[model samples]
Every structure is written in C-alpha cells, then in structure tokens.
Target: MRRPPMISLFTGAMGLDLGFERVGFELRLTLDINKFVCETIRANRPDIPIICNDIRRVSTDDILRKAGLGVGGPVVITGGPPCQAYSTAGKRRSVNDTRPSRGGDLVFEFLRVIREAKPQFFVFENVTGLLSAAIRHISFYERMRKKEHEIPPDARLGTAFEKILEEFISTGYRVKWSVLNAADYGVPQARKRLFIVGSRDGVDIPFPPPPTHGRPDSLDVIMGRKKPWLTLKDAIWDLRNRRDLEYLPFPSWGKYLKYVPPGGSWVDIPRELQREAMGGAFYSQGGRRGFYRRLSWDKPSPTLVTSPTMKATCLCHPDQDRPLSVEEYARIQCFPDDWKFVGTTQEKYKMIGEAVPPPLAFAVAKCIMKAVKEDPGNPYSDPHLKFNF
Candidate 1:
C-alpha cells in the first residue's frame, strides 16, 4: 500500500529532476557533476538531497546511506551521463574525443546502483545522432558501401543501446527504448532524443503516447488537424521590449544575432559580410541553413542546445534578432515559469536547454508511476495516465 520509496536522479540537471518532482514523486536524492548545477538544485529545491560530484565516484552505498533509505527498498533511478561522446554530432571519436565519453562509462555506475537499490523503473536519455550511420565514421556511407562489419559496438547507438538494455534485462528488468521528438509532445521545439525505459519485471515497456500535434506535410501526412505547431513568434513574443539590448545579448549571441533576420540569416547579411562570415563554407554544397538562419513563427523550434549563446546552432527569435534569452529558452523547452535555475545566466541557459522538457518528463514519469503504483506482477499499467502528441 505504501508508494515506491523514491527516485534517485543522476545526471540531474536543472528542471529535469524537477520534472519528476512535478509528478508527485519525492526527490530523495539528485546527483550531477556541475557544482553550479547542484547550486541551482539547492537554490530551488533545498529539501531534496543533491550530490554535486562526478557520478563515477559516487557509489550506491553513498546514495542509500545519504538518503537514509534501506537497501532493496523501492527506488527509481533516472539521469543521462554526459552524452557528448556518444553524440552523433561529433566525429565518431571514441575515448579520444574527451568531451565526456568517460561520462558514458558512468552509465555502468547507474547500473551498479540498480543492482543494489533495485528501483522499479528508470529512464536513460541521449541524442538521436548516436543512433545514426555516423557511428561508423564520417565516411559511414562510404565505409558501408566499401564494407566493414568490424565497427566497435561502443561506437554506435543501435549496438551500444542494445548492450545498455541487455545489462538492465540481465539485472532482471524489462526494457523498451524509442526515439522521441519533443515537438511531438508539444514542447514547442524540434528536439529529438532517445528514451530508454526499464522495469524490474520482464514486461516489455510501452512507447510514449503518440504526438499531439500532427507531423508536417513536407515531412509526411495530409491535413493532420491541430493548429500549426508553435513558432518563434509564439515562443518569445513578450521579450521585444529589450530591442536595443537585443544584438547578441550575450558573449555569443551578439555576432550571430546581428546577421540573422527575423526570418533570415547570412543570406540576408551584406554580401561582403556574407563572404567574410562564411569563409570557404559559402562555396560548400548543401543547404548551409544553420548559418545565419532565422526562425519561423509557424514551426516548432530546433533542438535547444546547452548554449543558445552560440550562433552556430542559432535558434534566433522570429521577429527579434537576438538569440533566445535564458527565460525564452526555458519557455520553448517547456519549463514552468516558477522553475528557477541555479547558477549564472549562461549556466542557466545550459542547464535548461540540456534538460528533458518538463512536459515530456511528466509523461514519462506518469508511465513510471504506473509501474510503481500498480501491481508489478501485472507488468506496468495506469488508468489515469494522460497521453498527448
């Protein structure tokens, strides 16, 4: 009759832990390597236990002992170690990339706690790029055409993910994983991430509810009702008063923001600056869209990155020229207004953009609570669970 003991959040960043918190689950403990992030957590939710250290160094004993929970008591684990190493964006560099592949090693640390704490369910999130053909190399298509099955398992998402799932299954948990786009769930952004869910029972986990907003016609589908997806206008319309201060409002936003028009970019810049800004990239083939790109008020936003201050991954305001502000970034990512982020402004942007959208997390948590609240023997089920695009 008692509820699951608690959710032990690892790689807990910004509002991601808070997402689980919104669903009526008590945050017994939260962990992340960034001191500023822990500061943020402590600032906003002081009652929750937050361990601000590398997950690699923290043991399950530390979590259990710190939270005062008994061994084997019900505990749900959630978090995503630094996923850059496994990211599809960077060259399929292995350990040499150094931007946190070792962070991926911390996944093992998460599994270690699973063996000890035995939570009912947990979710592992990562970039969809990791699942791409890039895992073979930049020349992946070439290499495949040329033939090479010898790719290392850790180098790719499909293979590496299977291993991650297998480890959980071996530990007596049923697992399911799917790539989900945040916009589909109404986050006002086009963020796509991989969600891996596992249950202690062998019940195959279910996919997230289908998207609320229909897919774009250009992408696929006929008149899929549901008003046009949210646009940049819809996202940051209220932040216009700061126009003079708008040019690249921060260290990075200034340069890129100057060139990107409300619905324009490098193409809109003076021809000389265009050549200067692009360098040889101008001559390169393909739709160099990201460079000096403008936002469309009629469409959802592109994936929110850790640094909106950076122009290269521009999510420029539709009418305004500056990069999305920290608060604007949070709104697009679906964080509630009251959800305060700890740390400096830049850190605030990073944590919020890097988080799982609160609504998406809410959906996932509701699914998790089903297993926690229902009969584990029935696998996982919920009657009041809400589903949206």
Candidate 2:
C-alpha cells in the first residue's frame, strides 16, 4: 500500500513532519504563521510547499489547493498548535488568552482544518498541561479566597480538554489520546507531551505506543523488556569540543553556576552565597531548581524550554559555565545535524526548544501506519475506547 500523504499545520522546525517523512509519508504541504519558522522550513526542505500565513486567515480551500487534494483526501494532518496558553509553565490563560496572535484559539483552527479537510487521519500534539487546563482561568489570589465549589464549571480543571475532545468527536472522528514522554522513544529528553490521534472513518487508532526505552534501573530495562534510556552523554558528547558552538551568554547569577556540580541546582551552592546568587528568587515558592541548574551527563535532560538562560528555567551545560548551545538544543530535540534553521540565534533556539522530538513522532507515525496496514478495511472493534490519558 502507498504510504499516506501528509499536510502539516503549525510546522515549527518540521521536526514532527520529518519523522513522518522518515516513515515514508510524503509531506504534501506545510503551514505556519511565523516568518522565521517558514523560512527555516523552506531553507532545509525547499521542495515541500508552504503556506506562510495565520492559520485563521488561511482557509481550508487554500490548504487543499496547495496540497493538491480534495476533501476526504488520503492524507495525515499533523501539528502542534502554539501551546503557551495551556502550558503549566505559563499563567494558564487557557482559551481566554487574548494575545494578538490568537494563541489558544489556534487549537480550534486546527480542528477547523480537520473538519473541512476531512483527512483520513489527523494527529494533534501539545504540552501535557492541556489535560488539566480550565476553559476559563481564575487567578490564584481569587481562587484562594473562594471555596472550591464556588468556581464555575468552565474554570474547573480539564474542562478545556473535554471541550476539545468533544469538538473532535463532533467532527465524526474516532479519537485516541495519550501523554507520551519523548525519552520513552529514545529522544534523550524526558519531554512529556499530549498527543491526540483521530480517524475519520471510525477506525480506532491504537495509541500510547509501547515505550522502547526506560530508566537504567527500571524493571523494564533490568529485565531486558526495554533498552536503557538515552542520556546527554549519548546525544552530545562528541560535540563537546566542536569549534562552531553557538549559545547565549549566561545571566548575572551565572557566576555562581560554576559552583553547581553536574546534575545539581541552586541548593548545591554555599548557603551564604545561595541568597546572593538567587537574590529575590531566594524567597520564592516552589522548587527553584532551574536556578543555577547544571545538566547531568548520565541522565536524560529536563524538558527543553525556549530559553535555556532564564533565571527560572536555566539549562546550563554540564561542564561548561554557559547555557546549552543551539547545536546542543537541536541534538537534544533529535534534529538531524544537517538540518538548517534560518533565523537569529534566539529564534533558532525557540524553534528547537518547541519542536516535537522526531524520534517520538516517528514512533507515533509507525504506530498509526501499523494499525492502518493491519486492518485497512475493517471498522474499529470498539470505537468508544475512552482516552488513555
């Protein structure tokens, strides 16, 4: 059987799309609103068509025309819409975010394209925070003053996701979703993301693809049920001495990062200097582990944020005093060495940090391919399987 063609939306850095391509999916067209992101895509994969405009302004007709497909085309649509609004790392604005770029509503736009394009299958990826996001956000101060019961249903955890699932279901697709860790798929990073797969023909997509990697001491690894997790040493040890390394200069507190041992953070500094290194953040709540943090050679990295030098989310190199280089960021995200990102250093980092690790995407694409190939003609045995979470 011919592999299905693919159309990608919000194709930041083409990481997910590249994975599908590796699995023999022909990437028909790609779309994104960011100029630099589109430029990066064109720079590396010039043969693929692109729609570089706001998804809201780009109609279903435009997408279909660019991909040369009619409605109900044998295509797989995949994307990770901008996830900041639903991200736990942020203020959890949820669907109420009113940024000029229409942050959260982009998910709905993804749904719109799915509804109109009617592809054979579609894959939606986002931060795992989507699972617990409320449709309406209530500030922490306001919530503290009010009883739990006083909060409206819209403000309740998971309400936003419930609505999203309902929207997918309403489009007549059989949907399956799960939160998957990239490290489980051998990406050398423990980035956990939410993935939703749907079939328009009512075929149940087998999801939560079995993990192929695990912690060294885990039962799965010890018993040879899975390979040991890949680590930073496995991903970037060769590049340690590379002359072309590109990275951001560390912040003011970076002077203290040298005292932090590999795998350690703010707490590792001397007690007397900890206050000075952390400053006002010293009194902040929550684990400020990212402060003065240094990477460990033996472990899978913590999730890659857009900026590795932020006081609250630092991703210092294990031995080097500076932040992880842009090349290192690409390596951790599993981008091919030759893949070119066309933008400023910061833009490159943002693209790499936000990408869905290709290894994880390949695993998902393979799972979907296996299901489709094994039972192409049959409807799903049970279309009502609740989401795997």
Candidate 3:
C-alpha cells in the first residue's frame, strides 16, 4: 500500500493543523512554543508527538532522532508563524525591529528546521503584508532605529519575499508563492493569506488549486459575481434557532449596537449616537471602517482576529448586538464546533484568529498534491541551481 504522506506541523496553533488532518494527511509530529497549544494537540491526539517550545530552543538533532526521520522519511512540514512585524496592520518594521520576535527571523527559524530535517516539502502561511516587506544589508545601511520608519532611498519591492525564497532555496528546495482567499474554498470568511511552498527541485511542486466552491458561473471571472460570497447569516442563523447558541454583551460597545440595524455600523447610528459613538475619531480619516461596523448578511465576513470584541478591528454580528463568540469565530475559520482549545477565552480567540482557515490550507495542499502527482521522479541529492537575484 502506498503510505499516506506524513506531515510535521510547526507552530501548529489553533488546530489549523486539524484542517490538514481532515484532508487525510497523517500528522506525525507537531511543534509549538505555547504549552497550551501543544497540550491541545496532545489532548486531541494523544498518540502524536508534540514538541512544546520554541524551535530555536529545541535541538534539531534531538528532534530528528526522536521523530525517527534519520533516513527515508518522506515528510512535509506546514506552519503559520506569528507575523505581526510584517503585518500591514502593524508597524512595517524591519527584521531587526525591537517590537517582538514575530518577524522574518522567526520564519528563518522555520527554515532552520527545514535545513536540518530536509523535509521533501514545506508550507508557510502569513498575512499578505509580506508582499511589500523589504531587506537590507547592515554594513551598507544606517541603523533601523534612526528615528522614523524611512524606506531606503532605493528600496525595491518584494525584497523580503525574495529573501524568504532564498532561505528556502538554501535548504535545497524550489519555491513558489501565492495569496489565497478563504471563501474560494468552503470557508465562509473572506480571509486572505499568503502561502509559500518549497519542494526539492524537480521532485514536484504544485500550484494552488482552483476554487472548488466559488467557481464562476457567470461573466468575466474578475468582475461578475458568480454565487455571491458567503455571509454571517450563512454561518450563525442555524445556531440562532438553537438554545445553545452563545452571545455575550460587551458592556462597552455592545449597548451602542442596539440602535444600529442589520448590515449597519456606527455610521448608521443616529446623528446623536454618531457623535457619541465616534467621540474623538469623529474627525478621523480612513472611514472609521469598523466602528459600529455591522456585518452584512449578503457578503463574506471580514478576517477574524483573536479579539473580535476589540473595536480597532471589530467582528460583530450583522444583526445581533454582541460580538461573535469564540464558537462563531471558530466556525468562520472553518474549525469544527467540537474542536476545543486548551486555553482561556482570549487565548482561544488568539489561536483561532491567528490560524490560516483550514479550507484555505487544504486548497493549497491539494495544489501541491497535483504537482507531486504530475512528477514523482526523484531529483539529485546534490543539485545545481542559482537564484535569479
């Protein structure tokens, strides 16, 4: 029998690993720095090995020795590293930015694992902000903290992405990348994420799979609306009828929502409420987009986060006054209702919010599968290739 391809999941938070699990990939090993997330992986699958700490702190030789992948272990590694430093919503600081460890260096840590394990394939996921990240050589450049965030006089685009590609190629793999929307798969959210997959040159590396659910049934693929995108109503209405459906009022923002209608937000509040609602931001630019932003029943959901209740990026229900519960957020991310997190509500939200929706993961996985199927031939253990820098 041809064995199922085993997957070693890194930074396997929120059981986004579970999505890959659902699609028949046997998860052989899981790694995470958070003990809770690691424990969740263990609790759910007591049989699988879970390494519960930073990869930098873990011994590569020890991990390989334990996984028994010394030789002939055909494996694929998948993970979504914390990407705040590179996030569009965050300060677009460089890899050396003192903000935190969630920058390109963490990704390089993942590459370190790839170099040591020599996995046949690996998948990396992150927010689309990577499309514009930059790179610099320290000797030729000024310090990062020279006062303000000033792009180098001649900085080119995709420098960060290309640097990431170079890291994977250094580990002996051919790499390709693309951004994907969750709604293209069966997930109801319009979450967009960048996916990069690297395979040993000439072995097989598939392009992303075409949309399975939202295929066009209409005019120009770009402009026309085929089946309209999935909406919050498509997700929670059934739960609404159930007595178990959960809802909690945010003492701060939930009350103000009482006056806003379905598909309406702070702008919809009466002139009095708008003034009261906006307060300081009344004169703020940028559309105050999420303020009292009621989700529309006719469109896909905005990207979910660890804290939907937070106003900076609210994810409130289109009709209900309360913010979407952990359950609804999980659903929006395509997690099974019973897929429990082993942490506080905030932690659970963080796990769920940070994950690349599984449907999206599976869609990308299938693309890699297609690439493998097309060319199963082996490549030289020692290969010759140069990057087009």
The most accurate candidate by lDDT is 2
- Residues 155-247 of candidate 1: C-alpha lDDT, one tens digit per residue: 443555555667767887777778887776667888888887887755444557556555566343355554345665566666667543312
Where does model 1 exceed 4 Å of error? Answer: 1-3, 94-102, 133-158, 216-228, 242-260, 267-273, 283-287, 376-389
The global C-alpha lDDT for each of the candidates, from Candidate 1 onward, is 0.65, 0.87, 0.67
On TM-score, the leading prediction is: 2
Candidate 1 — worst ten consecutive residues by lDDT sum?
A: 244-253
Per-prediction backbone clash count: 9, 0, 2
**Each model's TM-score?**
0.82, 0.95, 0.84
The weakest ten consecutive residues by lDDT in model 3 span 380-389
Model 2 lDDT per residue over 1-389, tens place: 45577899999999999888887788999999899999999899899999999888989999999998899774589989998899888588888785735388888899999999998889999999899999999886787788879989899889999998899889888899999999999999989999999988776667878999999999999999899999999999999988789988986778988789999999999999989888898998886867887999999999999999887899999988989999999999999999998888999899999999999999898767655655546332223333231
Compared to the true structure, candidate 2 yields what TM-score? 0.95
Estimate the TM-score for candidate 1: 0.82
Model 3 regions more than 4 Å off = 2-9, 98-104, 135-150, 153-158, 215-228, 242-248, 378-389
Q: In candidate 1, how many Å is residue 379 off?
A: 14
